[model samples]
Target: MNPLEAQLDYAFADTLPDIGHTLDVAPGVRWLRMGLPFALNHINLWLLKDSIDTPDGVQKGWTIIDCGIANEATRSAWENIFATQLEGLPVLRVLVTHCHPDHIGSADWICQRWQAPLWMSTGEYFSARMMSAGLPGADGSAMLPHFEMHGMRDPEIIAKVSQRKSYYPDMVPAVPHAYHRLADGQRLRIGTHEWRVITGFGHAPEHVALYCADLEVLIAGDMVLPRISTNVSVFAIEPESNPVQQYLDSLEKYRNLPINTLVLPSHGKPFRGLHTRIEQLNTHHQDRLAEVVTACATPRSASDIVPIMFPRALDAHQMTFALGEALAHLHKLWFDGVLTRRLDADKIYRFQTHSAY
Candidate 1:
């Protein structure tokens, strides 16, 4: 539908992994897909062949990357894969791409079963724990004020937003206590190939995407998605954070990889043309920024800009993320000095283009 769509081609656009089945994508790397109850119905996880030590000797196993959410159906699917695939080998290690529930939900169960430790970026590890820990001041406490300040005055919608604070535990009830932290450019060997950690930001703090230059493959977590743009938002937790800039910088990081590299995104089918996708994502936000600046002719709050940017019917849940993203775009404009923000008479924040900048 856009320039990037015309520029990039899906290597196997017609192919998709069946539920509970492993599709051989590359040497020693198997692609697995799982179901989710979201509009984005499914997520793709990876199973990398590996060998690990036991009491007697080394045995073949797997390293699961990006576990699916915690649920009975997902649990059943994993059970089926363990039985059908892996040839009776155990899961040697659990690697998480990020802290979102869809990506790390089953980590606790899988790790406990195989006695494997979670390998995740330091930020993602703690973010997942703190987010799902059901802490007193952690989850929903900040949303009330943030939404209220953003001009969400409807009592019913405000009530729904208020209830989201306690909703994390059901999605991700528990996480393991210990994990091995991954760092940028850290080379890790799996099976026969070496994967270097590529740290990305904005979408999630310190999100890690794995790159195997030897195979020309990149397990682009949420960084280089093929179809839907990753959500880059300014949550109530960090209302002033300039995530849009961080997201742009993160896309720039991916530009250094080969354009024709095979990209295995967490969502969507595997595809090539990383450069084209990067261009699309960058231009997507830049266009959004321009639209936002134009809209600021009449000092607009985040809620005021959501319809301008998204222009769709949003449910209560969708509205929450939309507001956060709208504010994120505004924060980037303010951060770059393209716009100025101030409190209005109603004690709501609004942005307007500065004459000089």
Candidate 2:
């Protein structure tokens, strides 16, 4: 654990659920880990013991929180989970937190396999469908031009990024044609407890985090992570979006939760420090924004700011997010009037301190 992580209480510090298995984290909630093909090598999924009234009477089963990417390895892992872990009860419902591939990639498959209904926020559901279908603005094709406009001009890097047109579709080949919508503040009864939906923005369209007061546990999807700060990016579809501001504002929604709530995040170990983690996240962004403002004393493009923010060698996949995050900070500063933006002679956007010129 790093210095920052030492400040929080990790409920499961000495144990981790192996792939295809689960460990109980809270009352009626179990934790599962899935592998991802990225620097962030894993995503945490949850299984909630649940039952619902049906025509046959009370149907008992489990509700799935997020699905791993649609790949053979992930599918095989799910197969193992189904055979051994589910205790013979079928999955009751599939609820995705957002449209991200790791969260919803295998949603259709899982739903189809168990004949369960898919549940997600309207924005996330539609965004998943659009991106899965490789629609104009949401597809990987738009990323190159968007990054280029923000001044990503490296030919080798550009070549790698241009080849990612099939990125989303490759992982998430399809989405369920229908879904049950999740909304902010809506109460959902999964098993013995009721969880309130807490929608957050900037990370994804409408990310839903679940809070169960009875259990004193918060399923903080990607809203408040323990290890790394959640990625708040200005993607191609929302060019002028100030997601940094949106994300910071969204953090305020969690202040009402109890301080010692056990937070089961989508990444990192389960920890008890809701307010502490939120403060860490806020301070993380504030520090990043300060660095950006300092760097913008001279004109800088999103690409120019990427190195200052990331300060490491980036692969093609990481570069996309890095550039987007750089632009997100710039857009936030621009929106706050701390910086000014202009299109340079090369048709690339650049930002500088408002008082620079």
Candidate 3:
């Protein structure tokens, strides 16, 4: 664990659920891990023991939270989970936290397999559909142009990114044609407890985190992670967005949660330092923003800021997010009047300190 991670208390410090299995993390909640074919190798999913009233009588089952990507390995893992782990109860509902491929990729498949309804925030649901369909602005095609405008001019990198046009669609081939919407502050009864929806922004469109006061547990989704800082990027669809500001503002929403809330994040171990982790995240961003401001003392493009923020070799996939995140910080500084942006002679956007400009 890193120094910041050591500050929080991990609920299961010595335990991890195997790929197709689960470990009970809270009352009626089981933790499951799935493999991702990226540098970030795993995504945590949850299974909630649940029941609901139906036309005939009370139906007993489970509710799945966050599906793995749609790939043969992931699908095979789900099949193993279904055969051995579910205890023969049906999956009554599929709830996704956001539109990200790892969270919603296999949603349609799971919902279809069990004939369960899909649930998500309106913003996430529609965004998933648009991206899955490879629509104009949401598809990978727009990434190259957007990054180029922010000054990503590497021919080799651009060539690699251009071939990823079907990246999102390939992982998330479809979304359920319909969905049940989850809204901020809405209460949902899953099993023996009620969870209140806490919508967060800047990570993804309307990401929903759930808090169950009764259980004193918060399903933090990507809002408050224990280990790595959540990626808060300015994607192509929202070019001028100041996601860094929006993400910082959204952290305030969790301040009122109990200090010892057991946070079940979408990544990392289950932890018990809600406020501490939030503080760490805030300080992390503040420090990053300070670095960005210092670097902008001279003119800098998003590409120029990428190495300063992420000082390592990046594959094409990581480069896309790196450039987007670099732009996000610049946009935040520009919005706060800490820097000024101008189009240079090369038609690339650059940011500089106001005095320098």
> What TM-score number comes out for model 2?
0.99
- Candidate 2 backbone collisions, by pair: none
Q: Candidate 1 — which residues are off by over 4 angstroms?
A: 1-3, 53-55
lDDT at position 169, candidate 3: 95
RMSD of 3: 1.1
Clashing pairs in 1: 140-165
In candidate 3, the residue pairs with backbone N, CA or C atoms under 3 Å apart (3 or more residues apart, or in different chains) clash, namely none
Model 2: per-residue Cα lDDT over 1-357, one tens digit each: 789999999998869999999999987899999999999999999999999999989999999999989999899999998898899999999999999999999999999999999999999999999999999988898988989999999999999988888899999999999999999999999999999999999999999999999999999999999999999999889899999999999999999999889999899999999898889999999999999999999999999999999999998889889999999999999999999999999989999999843
TM-score of each: 0.96, 0.99, 0.98
- The candidate with the higher lDDT, 1 or 3, is 3
For model 1, where is the 10-residue window of minimal lDDT? 134-143
Taking the tens digit of each residue's C-alpha lDDT, what string does model 1 give over 1-357?
A: 555565777777669888999999899999989998878789999999988667998778899998899999999999999999888888989999999989999999999988988999999999889988866555865677887788788787888888787666677888889999899999998877899999999999899999999999999998888888899998877778999999898888777787679999998889988998888888899999999999998789999999999998987778888888999999999998989989988989999998885
